[model samples]
Structure formats: C-alpha cells, structure tokens
Target: MTQLALCVMLVSEIGCNRDGLVICYVVIPPPDQQWGIKLPNDTWTGMMGQLDRQEVDMALGPFTMTPQRASVCDFSVPLHHENFAIITPRPKLQSDVLGFIKPFTVQVWLLILTSLLSVATAMGCVVWAEGKIFRHSEKNIVARAFLWVFCTVTQESSHWLPKKDGSRIIVSFWLLASLVFMSSYSGILTAMLTLPRVTVTIDSLADLVSQSALPWRLETGAAILTYLKESKEEVHQKAYRNMGPTIYALLRERQAVAEGKIAVICDETSMKKAMDLDFSTTGQCHLYIAQGKVMTNAMMSLAFRKNSKYLVQANHRVRILLESGLWHKWIGKQVANSSHCLRHPRLDRREGIQPLNLESFTGPVLILLTGATVSLLVFLCEHLSHLYVQPPKSTA
Candidate 1:
C-alpha cells in the first residue's frame, strides 16, 4: 500500500502473480508518474489525467480520498487510510520565565483579583452598615477586609472576623470559592513545578498557526495544497494564504522545520518516510510529528479507470492486503530498510513537570525582584518629596 514495489503485489492480485497465477493483461505506466489530479474540466492533466483520458487502466501510489478524484476515477477499496499530519521541530522545554502565571490565564488572574476586591468591598459595606447596630471599632475596616481576603486566599488563618450575620455570610461563600480556586491553582502549579510538565507542544493546526512566524507549507503541487485551498474552514484558508511557494527541491526549507523555522504538512506516508530518513541519516529524530491530525478518514488506495472490468478483482486484492496484515508487513519492512523512528513520541514525555529546579522558581523570583525594585523606587520618591517640601513660613 505504501511502497512502489508493493504495487507489484497489488498488480499480481488484480490478475497475475508469481504464486503460479496466470496473467490476462500487461501493465503499463503513464508518461508522467508524478502528475497531480486536476479538476476534470479545468484543462489540467496529471497521473489522474491519464486515468481520466483512458490512457492508463489504473494509477498506483498513495492518494487521499476526495470527492473530486472519485468523480474522475474509481478508487479501489481503501488499502489503508491515513490522515494528514505535520512535521515540526521538536519542542524543547520553554523558558519558565512566566512560570508562576502560566497555571492561570490573564483573565483568570484578573478575575481572582476582582473577586478578592469585590468580596472585601462587600464585607466592608456590611461592617459599615452594622457599625450603628453593634459596638465595634470602625477604623480602617476597608483595609482590614482586604487583608482578610488576601489571607484567606493564601490559606492563612485570619485572627479576626466580623461578628455580623451579613458579613459572615459573604465571608463564608468567599471561603468556599477561595478553597476551590486555591486547590486548582495549587494542583496545577505544583504539577507544573514538581512534575515534568512539557510545554503544551504543537498538537494541532491551530497551535501551529498560533506561532506568528511559524507558517506551514507543503511541497508545491501536493494534493494537500488543493485541500487547503478549497477548504471552507478559516484556519485552513488562512494557512493556504500564508504559505509560500515552496517546492520539494527546497530540502533546506524542510530542514528549517527541524530547526523550528517552519512547519511542513504531509500525508501519513510521506511524513513517515521523512521521519525514517531523518532517523537513518542522523541516528536521531530531528523532526517532531505533531500529535494532531489535519484530516481524518482519508483513504490511501490505487485508482482505476471507471467501469474497468478488473475493478472487482482489484478491490478483492486490496481487502486481502489490509485484512491479512501483509500491507503493514510490507510497510514495516520498507521502513526498517531506512530507519525506525517511532510513529510518535511517548505521550508522557511531555508531562512538563520535572524535579524542582532553580529554573522552576523563575516566575516567583522575578515577581519578588519586581516587588523589591518598586519598593526601592517608592522609598526614594518618598525621601525626595520630603527634601523638596517648602517650609511653613507663609503660615507663620
């Protein structure tokens, strides 16, 4: 199903074979082997063009199942199915510079701060309303309420609580909410710091596009380009627009992907071959296959001229290769001839958490340094203001 040599097996299965089977017809290849299927009436031609014009009985090699291709020629029952995948640079551990805030999003942090302020304001209002009915100190109740909220969020036991029903209710509900917020934050942050939390690797097309500079491209005239161009999805349309005119000859561009310059999208077979070639050439996996599939339920099959008498025999042969697992065996044998790069990396490798290290504390340490710098600036500004103050001579 994958290798050109395997096509011999398929050809044999259609009519003849070395297993004492006799041939009824001879096989022939169209002049252009690397032709892409053009829209039927678009006045374009390729491998599928040969089939369309009745120049070839069947076309071999991996091809994605699409409605357009189906209308032009009949595909045998899928020898195998493959989804589009991406090859990008292996993601290294991202810098933990913003590690502290990574656990919560900006909106989340803002909401948390808002919640604290809102609860404190509510409690302060309750205290003020109750001040007339009860006998308690009323000085700096706002500041005190703020302190209580802060301490509660930090899980610090507050030494005092307002002794009023309304204020107590506000505090009680906030306590429950804060418990959930703290537990989630703690669990996430702890997992981030104590366990190896791999940066959310590029797992999808959206993730790849999120990197402003990391545009994705495939070989010129690839079937995928047609898919991208005609796709109605916004991201797919955007990708097609942003892509450059890169051809397969631009091996350097693909190498750039290994260096994290850009990403390349390919059908499953091409991607597997590229990975295997990398493993064979360098003895290390330099490319990373994204965890997400670009397309699903894509069939890889041999194409036959419509209403060809051999169609039923080809379908039967394809089913045999698939059901018997011989197709996978041939694929594996071909893959081993080059190198064995696992289909994808181990999922646990990106759990992101590792043993606590100095790097893990980068976010907290940066916050502390920022606070200290601000405190120093405030101290300087205060003394400078004192020195510049005019004497009270005018009042005297």
Candidate 2:
C-alpha cells in the first residue's frame, strides 16, 4: 500500500504520466535472502546487497536505518519508525486460592494490619485508663475492647461500642477504613475470580534478556540481530549473548512459543502478522506481543544505492506522502486487515468473557482440603481427651 502511494507521489512530483512510472520487485523466496545487506563476499545478494551493487533502483519494506546499512545505501526520510516487540508464551495464570490476598500488595496488607493493631491497642488503653484511673463500671475492658475490634474486622455485630466521644471517634474512623478495605477487596477479588488475571512477565527488553526461563530466537539475517550485536548497551549485549539460533522462517516457530518452548524477538510488524495469522487460522490466540520495545531508534525508509539519482526525489516524495497522511493511512489499513483476533496485551491475556471452571480454582480446592484435614485432626484429639477424662462410664 505504502509503495503504491509512494509510486503515485513520485509520478506526480515529476509530472510524468502514470504509464511512464515502473515498479518491480526483486523476488526472493528465501526469507534470509530478503533482509540484511552485509557479507564479506557478495554477488547479487539480498535487497541491501542489490541496492549496494546498484542492481535494483530501490528496496522497500521496513528497512531499518542503521549506520552499517546507511554506509551501503542511501535511505529516504524514515517512513516507518518502531521498536521490536517481544513475542513470548503467556505467563501461567495464578490460581493461588489465597489469591484473595493479591488484591492488595504486601505493604498495603501490612499497613492495614498495623492500623488495626494500633487502633485496637489505643482503644484498649483508653478504655483501661477510663475504668482504672476513673470510677467507671467495667469488666475486662481491655479484653472486651480487643474482642470488639477483632469482631469488627470479621464484620460481626457487637453491642459493645465505646460511649465516650474520643473512643467513638476512633471507632468511627476505623469503621470507615475497614469499609473502604472491604469494598475494594471484595470488588477486586470478584473481578479476579471471574475475569482473566494477566501477569506481564516481561515488561521491558531488559526483562526479556535477564530471564532464562524461555529460550528466545531471532529471525535469520534480521537487522535487529545486527543492531544487538553492535549495540554498546548492556541489555542489548546480554540479549545478543542469550539469543538462541536464528530461524529462516518465523511462522513455523509460533507453535514453539505457544507450547512454551521458545520466544521470538521480532518487530511489531512480524508480531502482529504472527498473532493475526495464528488466531485467524487456529481460532485461538496463543501468542502475545510483549509491551517491551527493544530498539526505539529503528526506522523504515526507501533504500537506494549510494548516490543514486532518485535519492533526492525519493526523499521529497516520501516526505510529501508522510505529511499528506497517505503513509499512515496505508499502514493503518494493513494493520486493520487483521481485526478479527484482538488479543489483549500483557501476559497473553484471554478473552474477557472466558469463565473459569472448578478445575481452574486449584487454590480454593487446596484450601478446602487443608481445612477438612485440620478439622478431622482436631475431632480425633478431642475424642481421645474425652475418653481419657471419663473412661466412657464403664458399661459393666
């Protein structure tokens, strides 16, 4: 789409008739032969090499603009700009039956606990001072205050509320805070149990490189590999170090990612293509593009041989197409073609309407078993003690 638009722009700029303009693709079946322009000895190689040899007038695609690529061929103003998106297996769903605790972080839970303890202690102390220091009729004021506060935590009704204004004020604030916690926790936990909980295992390029869980691969002869190999940054260096063997084709490897065998480091174009193809073909979305970007400096433009006569005109035409919004429209059109499967981003999210089954609630099942076992043990111990205390009142 972009190429056709650029072709029309070029023709219009030169005031040449549409028939006079010619566009041809140097077709190569080998995926490896289509990308990267570098090699010691080259005789009519990939698009980059063909550009360098001046065999082809221009090469198109998201031809990444790098210093190494720039030294061989002149690039028009970058037409498409992007960073590589990591494609990996979705992180496993958390069925931690105790996932009820997950609605709040550890710090938040601790804060709640601290607040509860502080309020209970203060209530007990204040009540103690009132009954002990002053002539107030009270029995076990400290124990009763603690019990009332504990009961409040469980939402249990109690008749024992403080009579004094200061005590009542403290209780009121505690009630408000507890209500807030309960409302938020219940809403979140319900949503969690019903909806899919997506855990973004890899949020950045560094996260992908630092983790050794899944072996990651790159496309053979990709400029991303070249960028990583030559990059001075630690994350890129580590990514290069940890990169698995390169594959000529990326589509076949999508299954590997789905099966949790490997991850693919690819640009958004390839990522979306794979995702759409997988979903369209299988009717299931097993692949996901991570939210991380590998290289933010990557650019796409028309690649012309060094000092090619068309470089100046091509840049002008490219600029006109970009400014006129034709380029973005074409890109958007291409992306919109795969509108069928819209996989939510982050940790391989599923459709929002997927209802979890009993098997999925492994955490809750385990809790139930533990509770049953504890009850059985307590019942056995109680029976044993009863028999010891009153010998069953001998039948004889």
Candidate 3:
C-alpha cells in the first residue's frame, strides 16, 4: 500500500503517465536476504538475487537499507524508517472478585494479617493484666480485644475502654498505626476497583526471552532475525538464542499467536497485517504491539539493481514523498479503514462507568453468606448444649 501510494504521487509529480515513464514493481516473499551470509544453494532467492540477475527494474517493499545490501545494490532514499516490534497476544483482564486483592502480593497480605494478630494479642494481654491488678470489670477478654483491634483498623469507634495507663498507651499507638494502614489500603483499593489492572504479558525483548513458557519464534527469512543474531548486545543475542525453531511464514505465526501458543518478533507492517486479520476473523483484537521498538534506528528503501538508470529519479521522488509526509498519511488512511475492534481494543473500551455486576461482588457476598451460616450453626449448638447441661424446669 505504501509503495503504491508513493508511485501514484511520483507519477503526478513527474508529469508523466504511469504506463510510459514510471512502472511499479512488487517483490513478494521478500528474499529475507541480508548482507553478511551466503546461502548454500547456487541459485539466489529474493529481490537481491533478482536485482543481481537484472530481472526486475525496481524492487518495492519494506526492503531495509543495510551496509551489506547497500554495498551490492543501489538504494533509493529511505521511504520509511521503522523499528522492529514484538507482537504478542493481549493479556486477559482478570474478573475474579478476589482480584481486588491482587495489588498486594500474598506475602504482603500475610504480613498485614500477622501484624493485626500481634496487635490484638498484645492488647488482650495488656487488658487482662490491667483487669487482674486494678479490679476493673472485664468480660470476654479475647473477643473484646479482637473486636477493638478490628474497629481500630477499620477506623470505627469501639465501646471497649482501657483503664490502665499502660493499656491506654498501647491502644493509642495501635490507633495511630491502624490509621495509616487503613488510609493507604482504602486509597489503593479504590483506585484498583475503579480502574481495572491488566498485566503486560510481553513488554520487551527481554521479557519475551525470560518467560520461556510462551516459546517465541521469528518468521523464516525475516531480516529482524538476522539483525538479532548478528547484534552484539548480550540481551539481543540471548533473545535470539531463546527463540524457538524458526517458522517459515507469517500466517503460521499469526495462527499460533491467536491460539495462544507462541509470540512473533516482526516489523510493524507485518504485525499490523496479522492483527487486522485476527480482529476481522474473531471480531476481537487479541494482539498487542509491545511498548518499545527493538531495532531503534532502521530505515527501509527501494532496492534497485547495481548501476540502474532509474536510481537518481527514484531517490529524488522517494525523498520528496517522505519530506511531504505522504507516507505517514497513507498509513493512517489504511489503519482508519480497519475494523473498530482493531482500532479500539476491547480491554481499552471504557464507554462509561459500568454498573457493578454480580461477579464484581462475588468475594464479599460469599464471605457474608458463609459468616451468616456459621453463626446460625453455632447458635443451634450452644442451645443444645445448654439444654443437656441444665435440666428443664418441671411443670409440676
């Protein structure tokens, strides 16, 4: 699409009909040929080979400009500058009611519980000692202690009173601590419930390499793979080494990604094409383009055979098109024509404040129901025990 738009613009600018002066040539299954290595086969493949053999006038596509390829074939001025991107399935949004507790890890929650228990135990011991020494009226030491602790943590007033100076001092400190804890928890929990959190399954090349379960792979003959293998950086080298067996086609990689089997490292154009197709078929956009570009500074240009007569003209026209921003405009128009699912991902769609559903309150509702059932059972057991221990009054 980019090449076609540029060709049209070129013809208009040059004041010549498309048939006589300028012709658009396309190279499919991009030769995936890079400068450094020589394939084992005698016959060469891709645009480089065709250009070397003088079979085509010009090869159009996202043919990147590299030192090795530039040495052999003359390149037009860069048509587009693109950084390699990693495409992975969008992480699913968690809907479990207990998901509200996910902001804090299990260890953090355990620590909070331990602190609560310790504070309650300390308060109970202090209250019992004060009542024993001072003769204060005290009842249900353990239950009252825990109730006081719960009320303090919840920032609610408690009826229990501590008479001794030591007990009062402990309570005062506990209140201050509870205030801080409760305030922070409330603020964080509210933000979590209001704006749902979604985990990023894959953010960068390192992330993809570290999580080996997903088993990432590159398309066969992709220039990015060559770049990764040849890169001197340890991170890029490790990422390339971690890649699973090379998949020969982009369509296969797209299918694997849609099925949640694998992730593919590809250029933006290929990633967009796969995402568009995935959205069209499933009516949902499950793919996500990761945060940053892998190859920071990469430029793509048209490849012409060595010493081709059209090099100067093609270079001038491509430079003009790029300078005028026609390339970006054409890309925007293409993306605009895609489906809404692709343009606006489902996870990002927040039309308005959605009403809380039953699922949203599942954890709290279950806790309420369980507590009620247990309380009823305990009441029945206590009543039965009382009847057995004390004989009922005779009507005599």
Candidate 4:
C-alpha cells in the first residue's frame, strides 16, 4: 500500500525503417518512501475505478488479500512469508558466559559448560606445571603459569622446562600434567568434530514461544505487527518496538519485554546466525506469503489486468529466470569468495571459503604421538618411583 507515489515512462522508437514511429513507452514506478506525501482519498479511489475499466495496466504495492480487494483485482501468490515479531530493547551486562548457556537445551548448555571447563582445566594444569618446574617467585607466578599454558596447549616451542637435574618428581608431574591437558582438549575437540552443526528451525511465531521463553520483538512499521496485535495470543505474548534501540536493550538484559523486561526480539535468520546456523543472515527478512492452503509454496506470481495474457507470460518468464538457480549459485560463490564474511573464521571451511586456515593436526601422527607420550610417561614414573622410593624397611 505504501509504494505508489509517482510514475514515469521511457519512450523508444520501434523499427529500423527510416520512418520514425515510437511504438511503446515503458512506465517506471517512483522511488520508495515511507511517509510525507499528501493526497485526498478520492484521488486513489478514482484511480482504482479507472483500473477496473482497463484504463491502467496494473498497480503495484503491498496489497494483502481480502475479499473486497479480490473482487476488483487478481493477486499473485505471496512472494515470501510476512511473519510478525515482538521487538524490545536490550539490557546492559558484565561478562557472565553462563547467561547464554543457562536458558538453552541440555545439548547447548552442555557444549557451553564443556568449553568453559576445558579452559579452566588447561589453566589449572599450566599453573601446576609452572609451580613444580620454575623457581620463579610467586609475584610472577600467574604470568609464568599463563606462559606454560600458552606453550603446552598450543604446542608452541618454548625453552621453559627445568634442567634434568631438577627434582625428578616435579619433572614427572609436568609430564603427567601435559598428558591430562592434551587428553581433555582432544576429547572435547573430538566431540565437536563428530556432532552435526545446528541450523535454523524456528518458522512460526508459535514455534518461538514453544521452544523457550524468549521474547519476540516487532518494529512499529512492520506490517505483521498489526496482524499480530489483533490476535489475542500474539498480542499477549509478544512485545512491539519502534526501532532497534529498544530491541537491543531487551536482548542484552535477558528478560522478556512483555513483563517490561529485556529479551532478544530478532527474526529467525538473525536468531540462526547468533546460534551458528547453516549460513549467516544477510538477505531480506520480511516476505509476502499466500494465505490459502492451495497456494502454499507457490511461487509469487505477478498479476495483470484481466485479458492481458502478455503480462502473465512475461511474469512466467521472470519466474523461470528465478528458479534456474543461477542466482543462488552466484550468491554462493560470492559468499565463498569472501569467506571472511562468514562467522567462525578460524573454524573449518568445508565450503572452499578462503584463507582462514583451520586447526590442523596430522591425524595419525597426532594420535600415535599422544598415546605413546602418555604411556611412556606413566610407565617411566611408575618404574622409577618403584625403584627409588623403596618400601621403608619394616622396623619390625
């Protein structure tokens, strides 16, 4: 309803014959605008009357389906989904990683907790190794401990190990600590590699609430907001906002806006990206969908005034152009070419996404080296301890 402010046309000559005869003129719609145009209702009402009389070829705008409008004009199947949202403001916060993990499902929460635990365990092992080996003062204990962690976990080269003359027990413990660190790190890495990545699953407004108590956010001008507000369930469940300022506030706060608390109010695609779905959200979020069951999944068709088969044929050609998948292929290549555009730049790039090197380990060598190292260290510790620390002569 909002995209019909002005009209212009391009006139061109038709034939190569020496005679100059302009055959057709192509009318172009005006630039898009939201508000600030003034016109009386009768002006548009009269235009529609003329359109019914075939005085005009067509009118294009956001014209949703209704019985009255259908009587006067034919409509194309909806081009996309026009789902509503409940937008609200985000809140301020300090760094508590648990805030994100706590509201999710068991699997999601487990992954988050496991990551934290791995980091904590690695830090602990490094601290133990540093204290046991280095004669460094406790004043610089934290710095040295972190350096050991940096070298060991990442397998970086460092000359930090104590001389062989140092206490054998402490050396043995460093070996033990390294084994523990690698085992724990590798276990988590394996779990991650084996699991399939998550994708966007929420499709409908109802699905949002069904999955969790996350609040929905809607913009003031969003067409779906009006429809959602009319529905008793949606109106009660969702929160509406004028813009992103308030929406961001609720998201950061982790509270539902319905009860005047902050929560994330984003479209499904945005949610998917935040949750690491298949692809990043970049294209159009709003869509126009046909309501009737028969037209469900139907391609959005362009309508023409009655008895104009030419326009219908032209629309069909456009549909064929769209469905050929050339556009999809082109978009995919562009994204791959700029792989940096995707999230997790350091993670694996299975899609030929450019230069970010994935975490590389020679699989067989890594596994064998890890196993042999752990076994050698454990056996050496047990054998040496048995030989040196003799059972105290029973003073019997």
TM-score of each: 0.68, 0.69, 0.71, 0.31
- lDDT per residue (tens digit) for residues 1-396 in model 4: 111211111011111123443334344332222111112442223223434556556544333343334455565443233222323221111222222222345885466457434544554455556656774434454455456544654556666543334333443555566666566666665554443232333334344455443444442222233334444664233433221232322223322342334334333222222222112343311111111111122222233456653455444433444477543353343334223323332232344333312222234455668899999999999999999998977776
Better of 2 and 3 by TM-score: 3
CA RMSD (A), model 1:
5.7
* Predicted structure 4, TM vs. truth: 0.31
Which digits, one per residue and each the tens of the lDDT, describe model 2 over residues 162-231? Answer: 7666678889988888888888888998877766565767767888877888889987767888788888
Q: Which stretches of candidate 4 lie over 4 Å from their true place?
A: 1-56, 59-72, 77-223, 235-237, 240-299, 303-310, 322-396
| Candidate of highest TM-score | 3
Q: Count the clashes in each prediction.
A: 11, 1, 0, 26
- Least accurate stretch of 10 residues (summed lDDT) in model 3? 29-38
lDDT of every predicted structure (CA atoms): 0.74, 0.72, 0.71, 0.38
**lDDT of each residue in 1-396, candidate 1, tens digit only:** 235567767677777543757766656654543436575466435667788788778877656677878887888887777778877776554447777777899999999999999999989989988987786667889989999999999999988789889899999999999999999999998776654445646878888766776767776445787888889999888777887655552244547777777788876666666666667777776677777888776777878888987788788777778899988887876557334344344333444444566877787888899999999999999999889985677653
The stretch of ten residues in a row with the least summed lDDT in candidate 1 is 337-346
Q: Model 4 Cα displacement at 47 (Å)?
A: 12
lDDT of 3 by residue, 207-267 (tens): 8877877888776655676688889999899988888887755555787787778887766
Top candidate when judged by lDDT against the true structure: 1
* 2 against 4, candidate with superior TM-score: 2
Stronger candidate by lDDT (2 vs 3): 2
Query: Which of the predicted structures, 2 or 4, would earn the higher lDDT when compared with the native?
Result: 2
